[model samples]
Target: MRTRSLTSAAVSAALGAALLAAPAYAADGVPPGQNPAATETTNVTAGSTPTADTPTGVPSGVPSDAPSATATPSESPAGDPSPDPSSSAPAEGTGAPVFGNVGSDPSDAGFLTVAVSSDSAITEVSAKLTQRHGAEPATVAVSGFTLVSGTPLDGVWRSPRMSQLPSFGSYDVTVSARDSDGDDTSASGVTTVDVEPKPVFADRSISPAVLDVEHTHVKLSGRISLFDPISGETSPLGGKELGVSAQYGYSAVTAADGSYAIDVAPRLNGENATSVAVSLSFWIANPDGTNTYVLVDSKTLPVVISPSRIRLDHSSVRIKYGVKASSSGVVEYLYGGTWRPAKGVAVDMGYYAKATSSAAGRFTLTYPYLLSGDTSFTVGTSLDSYLDDPYLTASHAQFKVDVINRTSICFCTSWLDAYSDLHIQGSMNGSDGKVPPNRKLYLQQSADGKSGWKSLGWFTVKSNGTFNLDAYVSVPKGYWRLYSAGSSDYQPGNSNSVHFNRTATRITGFNAGPEPVRKGRTVTTTGTVQKLSGTKWAAFGKQRVYILFQAKGKKSWTQLGSVKTDTHGHFTARFTAKQDGTWVGVYLASGSYVDAESYRDYVDVR
Candidate 1:
């Protein structure tokens, strides 16, 4: 029985190869663990593999503790370099077990894997997992290594995983092997559960989700729970900095109970008040540099300025944008209820009035294009979904600022899929607040805007300014916009664009084990759909996953069957191999995620 570390100086001196920090990887396509005591360079004679039942002595660079991802594996200062295992005389006449790769899988978080091979019949192999937390230290056993291929003594082992670790530190791992002859030998190594502090926040709401632009700052307060939701582990984030930001930023302190409040200033992208999108991001940050809140909610918000901040003299084409701001470009002013960027693809603006502020909070639009003369005035609108400034609230108001001879058409959209017609609806209005009779609105779609828009269907404006039409849309996978080519006096126009994104999930770690399975024997196929949960791969469970197999004679991959992932985000299926081929899993996009294909797992059936 002996234990030692593997130092670069020693490995290089013996093997003549650069002995860098080589981390042994595990499952999810990572090779199984390796025996620490096993020499990197072997001198066994010929094809007849041989082994020693006992250690020659301790070797170089065995750390006193387990290896950590954050901490480099360092050699013990007291460790004395010794000759390679080949130089030591065997302590026993019986051939020892030749251990295979023994390492931990980074994806699995805190699991170590060991595969062993031996010259003699292997009776048993054991792995010890040690965790030290302050004065209290604990240990556990890694299980599920199935012997595949060759004799039981000289077989390949895979699919070994570790249990939930008790602490957040390094794990010392030691693997021992006993042969049928009752001879024993062991290999020692260390691994760690040093994962980044994962932050998962619970939902919280502000006192008033809506506000007025006149208010410089609005109170944004919420309760948060920092923890690994899937792991059911609570993360203590008592004193981390939390912030909400858009064009501007604000900060707050997380209370001991995960509560925090900050006054955030909402900065709109335009001059006249419009609905602004605001987000509270990285509300909490971990010491490991991990943060949460990937997709912040840009809910219904309006930062619209009342009394129509934009004074437009249509005859002279003079536009004065006035808003009270410490600086210009601080808030986006909107003349129309919605602010449509003038530079969108194939965008034909009948009337566009939107600008940010200047140092004096005054904006004058001298742009020659604003005078196209189609409407009396424009209302301010949100740039995207919500306002970034806390002071801004949500508004949808159409106003007239000047007396001008004008013809205009404006509309909104809605989807009705539950019915057979697949009907889409919209309401059009003019500057006079009257519905124009016999107006025509066409539905056009574009996969990419560069390719000219294609008309799908047309809707005749109703007497009430409403239009209804049903278009056979299989999936709303592309952008759809309403098109008005313009009637006698009205100008050509396109409505706001809409894109329905198909959600998708990603799959990884598709593995078929008992690597070398015999023909006609069933091998366990295990895998995971590696979904990101606050920067770490968390198991997405209770979802339908398809098992696909492609054999030599098969023309295409056929669905063998399906399986659901466990709470731990793992799925397993068993199949008897008739011949050698490949196995794969297809995870159909569930709610929130789109469809994904797992990495191909090749099964070698002998």
Candidate 2:
């Protein structure tokens, strides 16, 4: 047979076709009439310089249908061998190509990436997207994958932009990779497409918008709806459970009209919290039987607590030194522009007294005896841990009370002799049951019991709260009283008033002359009346003197006549000397002055 000459173009075309049509492994061990052992050696020898008898095309001993033994493009003498456009065999490895990372790009929603690794060069990479519906699954092929970098056998592949995918649904994705050896591997995964409407809250309100002790429970009501992003439309969503979170966690289900109402009790978690936050959460069931939570809409509400108020019946009180002081009031809290009783609350009254409020918010506090002066006190509400809900602000009110000291005086005029010192004794005591030593006390004199008082002297109080005073008297009579100037612990005090009289007077120079003269003749008796003035005798004007006569053997004296004293205090009287009797002159007492008398003289009537 004449040998046929084949050009390089024909040779390349034939090999490319054979590589496309042949499988990686035949059903039989090797092709008929092909030697498996010398396959490598034959291909190496044919690649050498062509002889005159052999052409540059096919080797002499190789069949036209057999595949080339060159594994890589560098080993082939025809430079790089063109791969078949249709199909290729799998790379020599333990299994098909291994798929690495396969997912959609987060930066570009429509772009998908697939990473595959193989022992030999990879020819193609593609993904199959099957959308899920009610029953049947619709599938669509996504090709046009380009290798990212490096060799195709171990690199990432990206698909073309496919942004028209539906949202709010699930998609089944299968990525396949083929190597230079026509070996194919596929990995299956699920991709979620969420473009559905989101739940929204509208016209939300919190009942009892402000929190107080009375309104601890808050009612939250709102209308829940869904917002469609594609159509820009909103509709009510019913029969869905929503979570409400604040100081406490609560849940509520929407009604058929998409309305929901929930109640929650919120308290102050810290000492100084002005506001609190309440959040609403919505969730939906995913296609893969999993649930997803979404924060559709959240609102921050203000938390305002009412303040406590303390009211007292009396702002100030006056009490005796030994009497107890008392105060009463009502405790209330401000809520909704009204004041309500704050029951079961503790109150701190000044002076270390404490009380609990009654059901009517009434409380009473009793204080011990205070000092003599005004004392300031305060009453306030105490914080209670049990009543944390509807917290109330602390409030207080101030008041004052006064205590007075008691003083007394006693005196006896029977022991007060003429021209003798006046004695006075008394006791001073405080209602507080304390004896104030070294306290100054004043002795006062008043003409009238009510006004025009004059201070006589001052004396210090003893440790036993008793006082005694001995005062020399100059004036005959006056009204006297004891006074005490109060200290910081006690108020001013005064004792009962008294009147004293100690006046002395005498009549001198009395003579009944013409002794024993004619029995029927008239006798004149003269005497001068005087008063004691600071140990000295002074003329006593406007005084009446009585003249008396007594028989020598008689036991009583008889008045002969009465006489009036002149400016010199001398008195004259005319009387008949009947028998031998004693003659005497006397002055009667009047208005704190003592009676005065003259010595008796003997007169004989013959």
Candidate 3:
């Protein structure tokens, strides 16, 4: 703590109700485990009046017996003044000040008064306090004096706090006045101020000088200063009957060492106080049993409580590629005490993702949930921003994500078994390490060398990342492939290409029966049409085959009889062997497939 020092002699005097004698803050210069710079001299000296005019710096409208306010530097001193202390007489004409009877000054007692001048012409009037004890005289200002009602003469001067002087000495005082033209005169009061040391609080302190509004009590500790002016001795005023009051309701009594504790419930601060300074003024009860109080020293303590914010790691992304982090951080703010976790604080995901704060104010968030085909996305918001916490204000954070397209391979068989049902199988995944489950996979076909891929059919993807489609090859194409129409969390993809080409129908067996037949005799022909699946020829059923006959010397052959293959794919035809030389069986080509012919087997007739 710092003290207010007076330059020259120090005298003891108090102003009216303002406690003008209230001392400037003082220090023993050392506290428990701490050292401070030199303290200022707490001295207040009485006046040696100004020759030109009283130093007009006092604030206006004081208690009775103080000076009537003269013109301030801003207001002209031409019209307002008290003509007589007894009546409400306004002054006339701008003129020099007049002086009257001089009263006793500081040397005689602690209080003094005088008769001075006031008129329409007077600008500013005051009593200036000057000390003459040292080599050079120094002045200390004592303001807020009230004019005595008896008569208007000289204005009295006093300090606002009524604190006692820092040092003991005699003080000479006088009255002075000035007019608009700056002319002035001064007269000395007969009385002089006699100052003496008074006991007070020398070493005092408040624990945790800075505090939170929630603090319920303050710890006050101190030892009173005891000095005897007559005996020239000093001691501690222990076991004193001192007391501290808060707003005249709550108070605490001093212990043996003058230490005390004060309850601070419902803190004495403004409504919106984040940080505030409150004065704890010290006083003691009068020993006269009159229940009156006497002034002491005052110490100011600062009391506080501040809002929260979130810091983000990543701020942008793309949807087709799949985003990595929706939120890379957490909400940090003032809570139980200093800044720490705003744990469990929910962060809003505006069509992007979900998030919540954890330890050390951290949160994890993933993106693109149930939101597809987004060109631009602003999401992962910190709804904590709307909390509007007074100690920690609200803040928000977000990330931007987008969607795009990519290339993927669809799996299909190189050779299609037209006999069996045509089925395609494949898998789906993304670059961001996302293997989407329970998704749809489509089978598509394209023209030989051109045209867009048309979807044939679709199937659901299994948990193992694979999917299959069993579909009939109804509308065949030269090339085929698979597709994945992306979901909200993944991008669209494709599979490797393929084609649908039916294999040729083969002849497994063929025979011409009834060797050496006579004319008009019936001859039977038989054959089997088959398809190779793996290493075995499987029957090609439900198809027609032909038995042909050619005359011995003719190139063209005639169709003797037509027969359809049975379940085993075997066909037989009977015809009259009319001058027949040899017979052959033929199979025809159908949609997107080649045909097969049987080897000639000769049968002769006579």
Candidate 4:
């Protein structure tokens, strides 16, 4: 092989000294010409005459400079710039040595290259294999290649250029050729074409850290970059897949430019505060049997769920009533697509109990269990459903009456009559103690079974216990029961029922007056009246007939007349209304008979 090395010059110097010491000669022992071996460029032609520089008795008996007598110019020819005494021909070798540029096997031959691009496109390939085998110089075989491994080689198997194999890996190429004896030889070489895996965006994030439990809406935004191990450039991660998920299994994808965003909301079933982390991954493969995947190289974002801002207030105009709750733990209602506080608002003691000072708008809700009317309240909190397991809700809270009753009265009088006045006062109490102030009180009483129970009046309780009532009656002679009705300040249904009786001494009958007569028309009115006897109507009994009457345009009237009556000596009348307006008539017992109070009358006219 006509090869050149850095040490070739020194070897030439030593060759000259050997040539001077020994006489160059053939086996014939003749003197060999000492002219430095001249390199002759020859177009050696078979059967042609040798050139002038051709030497006799050389190997193959063909001079080294004889190109006209050599194979065609297309054939590979050896060259020698100089010859010394040390230069000698082979000692009659046996047969031609194996000499083609290729691998060990005929089937193992091809080419390997690499691909590089700004966006995953192949860019360049290796300069064809320049290594040599024996005297024949090797080349990136363009044809006649076979694959002992990797891609199969055919008549025209193509080499993997720098572009085709964009990923990193090892590539094998084989080239085969045939010698004069018709023996096929092949050679293969490995090339490493590595294409790095770029970075991909995993997910996005939001500012202000955690998402509070009461927080409904949140803003989403973040950045992404290619995670290339080989280079730190921000390469495009187009067509890549990404995911973002939270405690409730919420997830999102990235854009072509590696940017990603997502909105985290409460699950269909509401929850508590939570913190979530985002992640990313990238994958790539190479021709040399190598692969890679990067984790979180681009960017890591976080999602925070803040607590919900729940405001509970009294739904009723009157704040004196109790409220009812719908749910338990982490109670919430859907408001404007987000979770809010439950209805029937009430003070949450668990929250207020915390040492953290409550803000101005902060208030507690006291749910009504037994009180009348609608009332409730709510407060603001900072917590997310995700972080905490069983979130704060109606079920988790304990509800009780907010306002306690404190004012009540209980008094017993020694002397009581129609002419005497009575005064009574006191304060109310709860299971604990005297209830809070500002509550109202009421008084109720039932007259001797005749008038029944009736509400006297309502009054506000003052710091001092003082209240008065006039006990004057037209005919005072009966029993009475007194009590109070409940309110925000007072509990309905009195705890105790008080009773009292008046002296019995009534035995006088009024005059049997004339019946009412119309203005211009004559109307006859007659009746039998009763006499009050010892707190009872004794003269008013069976066997008596009485006519009661009232004048037109009058609210009060009396018994007109009476007769010895019914089964004994009964009486009747013919009455007429001379004018329009209202009137009343009654027929009662005039003689001795008990409980005869049935005949009552009423009349109206236009």
Name the best candidate (by TM-score).
Answer: 2
lDDT for each of the candidates?
0.46, 0.59, 0.47, 0.32
lDDT of 3: 0.47
The parts of candidate 2 lying over 4 Å away from their true place are: 1-187, 190-205, 208-217, 222-244, 247-261, 269-272, 280-297, 303-311, 319-324, 329-347, 351-374, 381-395, 403-433, 436-461, 465-606
State the local distance difference test value for candidate 4: 0.32
- Where does the lowest 10-residue lDDT sum fall in candidate 3? 68-77
Model 3 spans > 4 angstroms off = 1-202, 205-275, 281-311, 317-326, 329-398, 401-606
- Which tens-of-lDDT digit does each residue in 1-606 have in candidate 3? 111222222112111111111111113211122111111112221222122343322212211111111100111112112222222212644334454433322211233333444343444444544554656655554444444322232232222221333344545555455545455655443234544333434345655555542343555555554333323334554555544443233455566554454555334433354443323433222222212123343445554543566777767665454234354676776646677766655665554466667756677766534233344433333343442232334466656656553434335223356554555555565544346643677767777525787887777777666666567766654666667777665667766454446664555457786887888888888889886576466898877888777786576778877789999899888888778466777776477543555655557677
Ranking by lDDT: 2, 3, 1, 4
Error of 2 at 20 (Å): 35
Q: Candidate 1 local accuracy as lDDT?
A: 0.46
Backbone clashes under 3 angstroms, per model: 51, 20, 51, 92
lDDT of 4 at 3: 18
Q: How far is 603's C-alpha from truth in model 2 (Å)? A: 84
Winner on lDDT between 3 and 4 is: 3
Candidate 2 lDDT, 165-198, residue by residue in tens: 5443445667777777666665555233333344
> Taking the tens digit of each residue's C-alpha lDDT, what string does model 4 give over 1-606?
111221334333322322211111122211122221321111111112222444321112212211111111111112221221122211222211111111111111112211111111111112334332224433432432221111111111123222232222222333233323223333334221222332323233453343433443333554444433222223545455544333344445557765655555533234433433433333343333333333332222233332333333432233222223321233354445666543322324334322111333234433324333223433223232332322333223223334433233432221134463323333443322444344455555555444566666666545543344444333333333334455465445342233333321111222222333334554443334343344343333343444456554464655655444343222345444544333223332123322222222334332
User: Model 2: how far is 122 from its true place, Å?
Assistant: 28
When 1 and 2 are scored with lDDT, the better candidate is 2
Give the root-mean-square deviation of each candidate in angstroms: 36.9, 33.8, 28.8, 27.1
The residue-level lDDT of candidate 3 at 350 comes to 55
Give candidate 2's error at residue 141 in angstroms. Answer: 17
